[model samples]
Every structure is written in C-alpha cells, then in structure tokens.
Target chain A: MQKNTFKRKTLPSLAMAGPVSLWMILFVTLPMLYIIYISFMSRGVFGDVVYKFSLESYETLLDSTYFKVILKSIKAAFVTTVLCILIGYPFAYYIAKKPKEVASKLIMLIMIPFWTNSLMRLNSWLLLFQTSGPVNNFLLSTGFIDTPMSFVYTDGLVMVGMITNMLPFAVLPMYSSIEKLSRSLLEASADLGASGRTTFFNITLPLTFPGIFSSIILVFIPSLGIYTVTDMLGGGKVLYIGNIIKNQFGSIRNWPLGAALSVLLIVITGLLIYIYTRFAKIEDMEVL
Target chain B: MSISRKQKGKRRQELLGTIYSVAIYTILYIPVFVMMMFSFNNQRYNYYWNGFTTQWYAKLFNNSAVIGSLWYSVVIAVLATVISVTIGTIGALGLKKYEFRGKKFINNMLYIPIIVPEIVMAVALLIIFIKIGLSLGMGTILIGHCTFCIPYAVVTIKGRISGDGYSLEEASMDLGANRIKTFLNVTLPSIMPGVMSAAFLSFTLSIDDVVMSNMLAGAKNSTLPVLILSMNKTGVTPDVNALTTIMILFIVIAMILNNFIRNALKKRAKMEENI
Candidate 1:
C-alpha cells in the first residue's frame, strides 16, 4: 500500500510537472542565462561572440550615444506612463462606477482594440495622420490652418501611439481595484459628512493606490522596451533603447552589445516588478 | 428641497461620468474605426474619401504573399496553442495537486515571462538560438513564442484549477476509479473551459505577436504581421487595412465562440446541480 501510495504521488508529479519544467528550463531559463553570459563576452570582429571575457559591452552602454538613447527611452516611457494614468484613471473610474453589466460591457470595449494587433492600430494612425490625410484636409478646409500639418512621423505622434497602446493596461487593474471597493465605505464617508471631492481623495484614491502603481509599472516597462510604435510612427528617424538594441542585433550585428542592452532592460523591468509586488498582490497584476 | 438638490447633483454627476466614458471609448476606437472604414476606399491613397469599394478586400484575398504569411501564422499559432495548452494544463494540475520542493518558487517564477519585456526575451532567444546554431525560421519563432506562451497558459489554467473547492479526483479515487480514469473523466471535463480559454489566449497572442516573431523570423518565413510590417516600410495601403480588419474580425469571432462555449458549460453545470 505504501509503495502504491508512493507511485501515485510520483507519477502525477513526473507525468504532469516534468515536461513543463524541463521546457521552461531549456527554452526560457537557459536562454535568459545565455543572454547574460553573452553580455560579458567580447563582440567578435565578424559580428559573433568571441568567447573572451570583456566588459566592453557594458562600457559601450556608458557611451554618450547609448546613454542618450537610454535616457530618451526612459523619458518617453515616463511620459507615456503619466499620460496613460491621466487618461485611464478617469475612464476606469467611470467604468467602475457603472452598473456591473454596463461595466463589463465597457471593459469588453476597451479589450477589443487591445486584443487586435497593435501594428494594425499604429498603421491606421499613420494613415489617418499622413500628409493630406482627413484631419489636415478638414483643418485646411475649415480655415484652421493654411497648409497640411506635419502630423505623421513626429515624436508627438509616437507618444500618442504609446498612450493608446498602454492605456488598457492602466485601465484594467485600476478598474478591477475600483470595482472591488465597497460601496459602504463611500457611503460611510458621505455619512461622516465628507464632501464629494474630499471623499474621492480620501476614500477612492488611497484605496486604488495599488492599482495605480501596478498600472504605472505595467505601462512603463513595456513602453520602455516596445520599439514598434516608435519605428512605425516616428518613421525610423527616432530611436528608443528598443530600436537601438534591435539595430545592434540586426544591422550593427553586435550581439554582445545587444545582449548587454537587453540586460539593462531586464534590470529596469525587474526593479519595477519588485516595486509592484511590494505595493500589490502578484495575482492582481491583470492586463486583460 | 435639500434632498432634491442632492439627487439632482448626483444625477448631473452621473451624466457627466457617462459622457467621459463615451469620450474615452471614442478616443480608444477612432483609429480602429477609421482604418476599418478606409479599408473599403476605392482609392489606394487615403488622401480623399473615395466611393465605397470592396476592391481592397478582393485584392487582399487574391494577394499571394498575404495569404501565404497568414497560413504560416495560423499554422504556428495552432501548433503553439496545442503544445502550450497541453503543457499548461498538465503543469497547472501538477502545481495544484502535488506538493513538491520549490513549489512557492515555481509559482513566483510564473510571472517572469510576463514581467520581462518582449524585446529582452526576443534578444535572449535570438542569442541562444545562434549559440546553439539553430537557424532562424518558423522553428526558432515557435520556440520563442512558446517561451512566453507557456506562462500565459499556466496563469489561466492554474487560476481555474485552484479555484475549485472540491476535488473530483479524490472522490473518484475513493470510488475505485483509477488515477488515469479519474483524471480523464472527472478533472478533464471540469477544467475544460480553462483549457479552452488558455488555448484561445495563446493562439491570439501568438497570431498577434510582432516583436519576438520579427526578431526570430527567417527570410523566407514571414508571418502576416511581419509581412504587413515590411509593407509599412514603403507605405500602408487599404489592402493592408482590409487584411487587418479580417484578422480583427477573426479574433472577435473566436472570442465570441469561446464565450458561448463557456456560457453553455456553465448552464449545463447549473442543470447538473439542480438535478
């Protein structure tokens, strides 16, 4: 009986857990390890790893060009994060304040665009804001502007794209948190004679602080790393750290430098995630 | 009079809130709506609003490159979904059922795939693939995708598996149904929605992905988004718009179908409980 019991326990663990753990160890963990390993290796003359120990890649990170790229990427991501919160908080508030059915429907509306490929949305933005696009035509016809505005291929438009892409991430967590807020708490605040604004500040904001922080981390980290928006919307004239890293691997053919840049990104993401866990439950980190 | 004034104030606040909601949704969807509308434009360049035509849709349908990449994307998505979901379901069950060393650590590790930026994972996979001399192609792209896709599957399936209060497997074992039979008959049906949802989630994410796929894709095996991306280097056309609309429509249909199945399953469960 003891032997049978032992077989039962071991069988499930081996049969069920073994394949996935092995897959992750092979594909995910090992690949991440390889990235770190290569980050310390020297860049080969022919664009391959040279297998010699060197901090040249990390030194390259301190180069003025890379430093500027990293700084610019952080600024853009910070701007995007702030804008997402500014736009999404009120939107999430509106959703959470609605009846449950209406709220779910509104949430679904937010998600529909989210699930669609972001490249498509960015394409549409390009099309809409292209030279002589509808907005320019309307402004010209309405006498608002004398000529077509240079709306496409601008830093401003890239920021706009980032805001749209990251808005849902900000909204989902805040909305979920706000929905979990007890009506009695608000009612009690009112009963205690707090003004509407006072109640909102005291009761609503503090309660949803975790959601707000989660939104910040979620939006900020991806915005830092996602190059697609800048690549398409900025017309490749601009470069974030993502584009720089991508160029390193693609055109520059510097794998070690690319790996080093990736490690920096990983560090930034890890720090933000560590902060996020401190503020909120890990399970509450909902993007959908 | 004060109560009436308070009620009026609340009513006005609600109205304002509704308007804000509408405005937010409008900003969120205007680009997508514009694209969908422009997809039917008779003109290739979107400078002017030409009369409606299904020409772009027709052209897209006949476009060999678009069709080929789409087929490749679907094949990759389906395979990734099947593999990831099977692994995820099994892993979720294991994590829930078995007490083992590093269980807490494994649960925490689930978030790494999600928390790490896609580019980092993309570069990591690229570096590793090159180190191992695996040629960049669909195979490389598939491995890159599964790296993140497995974690997504685990999150979804594990949530469902753990949320249940009772263990049908334990009950079945008590009744002399063997381990395999209990899992097949009891546990499988119970978590079918989670499995299906995880499958859909992985499939959608895989199909819609661009960065990892682009980084890992070979010259001859461009996915549809990658194809569209290449086209964007020149300029996007209404045909591309039409293609996107189709993809969006396809996903919406898939989601609705999945939701329908979930609802039906819930209703059947309700009936079973009543009986």
Candidate 2:
C-alpha cells in the first residue's frame, strides 16, 4: 500500500521533469554530439558536409597559423584574467569586510553595469576612445601629444575593454567567499605573533583559493569565446579563435569548419572545467 | 581595554583601505562617465563636444528600421521568457522533490548549453534545421533563445525551490487536495519569486543576445543589436551613440527601481518589528 501511494504521489513530478530532460538531451546533448561528429567528417569543396570520416580538421589545427591563433587566444585570455584578478581581489576584500547593508549596495553597483548590454558597453568604449574623441582632445590640450594618439583598433584597447567587461565576474564570487571567511582566524593568527602580511598570505589567501579559481574560470572561458569585444575594439584586423569560427559560419560559408572549430573550443573548455572542479569543489564555485 | 602597537597597525590599514577604495571606484566610474557625457554632445564627432543637443535622440526615434527591430526584440524577449519559465519551473520542482535514475546525468546535461559557446549551438542547430527543411525566421530565433534560457531559469528556480517551506503542500494534500490542486494552492506561490527573477533574467539576456540571434535571424527578421552592429561597421555615427545611451539609461533605471522597492519593503518590515 505504501509503495503504491508513493508511486502515485511521485509520478506526476517525474512526468514533469521528463519533458525538460528530454529537451535538454535533444537540443543540448545532441547538438554537442553533432559538433563532435562533424569535426571528424571530411569537408567538401562546396563547404557542405562530406559524409566520409577523416581527421583533416584536427590535422589542420596543427598548422602554424592555427597554433598561433590558439596561442594568441590563450595569451589574451591570460592577460585579461590577470588584470581582472588584480583589480577584483582588493575590491572584493573591501566590500566583504563592510557591514552587510553597505556590502549589498556595493555588490549592486558591480551588477548594475553588467545589466547593461555587453555589446552596447563595448560600443561605448569605442565612442569614448575614438581617435578624435575627448581622450585625445584632453591629451592634445595638455600638450602630451601634438596629434591625437591612435587609441581604438589597438591590442591594448582590446585588453582594456576585455578587462572592463570581465571585472564583475571576478569580484562577486571572491566577495562571497571572502565574506564567508571566519574573522576569528585573523584574530587567532595575530595572537600567535605572525606579521599581518604573513597572516594574510598564510591564512586569508589559502581560504580564498576557491573564489580565485571561480574568478579565473568565469573570466577566462568567456574571454576566450567572446568575439564581440575583440572584434569591436581590435578593428576586425585581429582574429581570435572565436572570430575565426564566427567568420567560417557567417561570411566564409564554411559550416563544417565552423563546427570543427566549435568542437575544439568545447573540448578545451570542458577540459578546463573538469580540471577546475577537481581543484575546487564545484559547489564552492557557484557565483550567485 | 588594551592600548598597544596593534591599534597603530589597524589605523595604518584603514588609511591604506581609503586610498585603494577611492582608486577602484574611480576606475569603475570613469569609462561610463565618458560614455554618458558624449551622449548629449552637439558635435557630430565624439572628438569634440560642440554643445548640448538632443538631435541624435530625435533621429533615433525617427528611424524606422531601429523602431521595427526594437519591437521585434521586445516581442521575442517576452515570448522566450514565458516559455523558459514554464519549462524551468516544472523542471526545478521535479529535480527538487523527486528522485529518479540518471538524475545526475540529466542535471549536468542542462548545463551544457550554457557552458558551450553560442556559436557552436547556433551552427549545430543551423545544420540540423537545414537538413530537416526548417526555414530560418522568428520561430528559429525563439527556439535558439529558449535553448540558452532554460538553463538560466533552471538554476535560478532550483535555488528558490530548495529553500521553500513545503509543509503547506503536505497539509493541502492531507486535506484531500489533488496533487495538481495542492501544487497550485500551496507550491506555486512559494516558488513565484524564483519564477519572477528567472523571467526577468531571461528577458534581459534575450534582449542583449547578439550571437545566436544574429545567426538564426533570417533576411526578413533582423534584430536591433544586429542593426546596430552593421551601423557600427559603417563607421562612427552620433545616432548609434544616442541609441546606446537610451538603452543604458533604461537598464540603470530598472535596476534602481528594483532596489528602491526592495529597500522600501525592508524599511517597512523594520518599522513593524519596532511597533
């Protein structure tokens, strides 16, 4: 009787979840499978999928140009990640130590900028830094330069845009983790005669490693795949792996190549995520 | 009760804290301030502020293409939000309240759409859709959006679902309410906050999305972001700045309003406690 009653009660909930599960399997899992499959398929001259199995795309990935692009992507992502961490860590520590009400307000400030469209934000950066813009005007007026310095369409500008875009993602997780840290530990460490610097390095840093890991993943992965900021700020001359993949599908009409590139991107991202979760508990990485 | 060198150390730390805090806030605000100031610049070029003017804003309103794309974006955002919330609420409840085989696997699968690049998802769907003879249009864009939207909704709703007090549902069921009736009367109200936030998030995400929407939108149905992107490619224009400024203003106002309402409620609760 108990078994029957339990089945009756639970059946509807199971049914409720079933459709969503199927949808996830079909749309999310199946497409990922398809991407992997196409990565192995031969590319035809007409840019259509040729059904014959081959490893040509993976082989092409070994070419120097592709290697350079991948290296460049990694370097760019690394720089962006470093900048975000340096800026975000102190900001997060400050907010975390504030009273609860004040900390919440500061957190809201970080989030409010994020709520604005990322593309729009990128565009605004373009406007503010355009060669003839106020920045150049100010510099020229100060006699810092006789001519307006070329600002947009440069790698440095792209990095600045990327760092701005990703700063919040690094801050929020670290703030939460730092906030959760026990104050008594600091008090305990001071009592033991350790210098403040030593206490911070030994105690606070170790406890906050999970947040740092989250900041890296959250910043690095998106910075790797996002073409919008780079494309806008870098003036389409510079092509990250993301812009290359986008071009293949959009302008180049090379679906198979795009699919192959995507498969590679996914594989790299998945490996990183797997490594990250191993190093830091997945539950500890939740940002929100 | 103690006066020592430790107090001196704390004072130095506070002084250092003030300097760092001031520098960080300046870094955060400067770029945004530059953007906001240029919005009202009378000069056609952002390089010079000729004077204050609203001409660009006027031009933004008069442009038919911009208006059309904005309307379509709004419509798609609303539809996507509605569909995602319905599916996500059901999915969250199921995950929270029940146990089933392969549940862990299923839960992980939901995250795949979110973590994978949108270009990958768009291209994969494009290949499949073309193979099956599905034409690109509003329907395709909506589906593409929902694929990403569902995961976000599930995550938000799942958080709230786990925190809910379920005794009301148990009581309603014990009083001979059917499962569906009990869910409506007891469970639904408790989960409404999750649903609302999920819907809000989905709407914002859909409206801001350019990658998938750009891919899925056919010749007939270009989105606002796409239009702006092409305009940007054409070169600098004051009209684009005006449009972006309006979008920024709308988002900031919405956020401030949300915070204001939340603070007001908190103040009321404090007063009630005192009384």
Winner by DockQ: 1
Scoring each candidate complex against the real one, what DockQ results? 0.67, 0.54
Model 1 clashing residue pairs (backbone): none
Q: What lDDT tens digits, residue by residue, belong to model 2 across residues B24-86?
A: 777666666666666688876565667898888887788778778888998999999999999
Q: In candidate 2 chain B, what residue range of length 10 has the lowest lDDT sum?
A: B231-240
TM-score of candidate 2 relative to the true fold: 0.93
Please tell me which predicted candidate would have the highest TM-score against the true structure: 1
lDDT for model 2, on a 0 to 1 scale? 0.81
Task: Quote the lDDT for B70 in model 1.
Answer: 88
| Model 1: residue A272 alpha-carbon error in angstroms | 1.3
Question: How does each model score on lDDT?
Answer: 0.86, 0.81
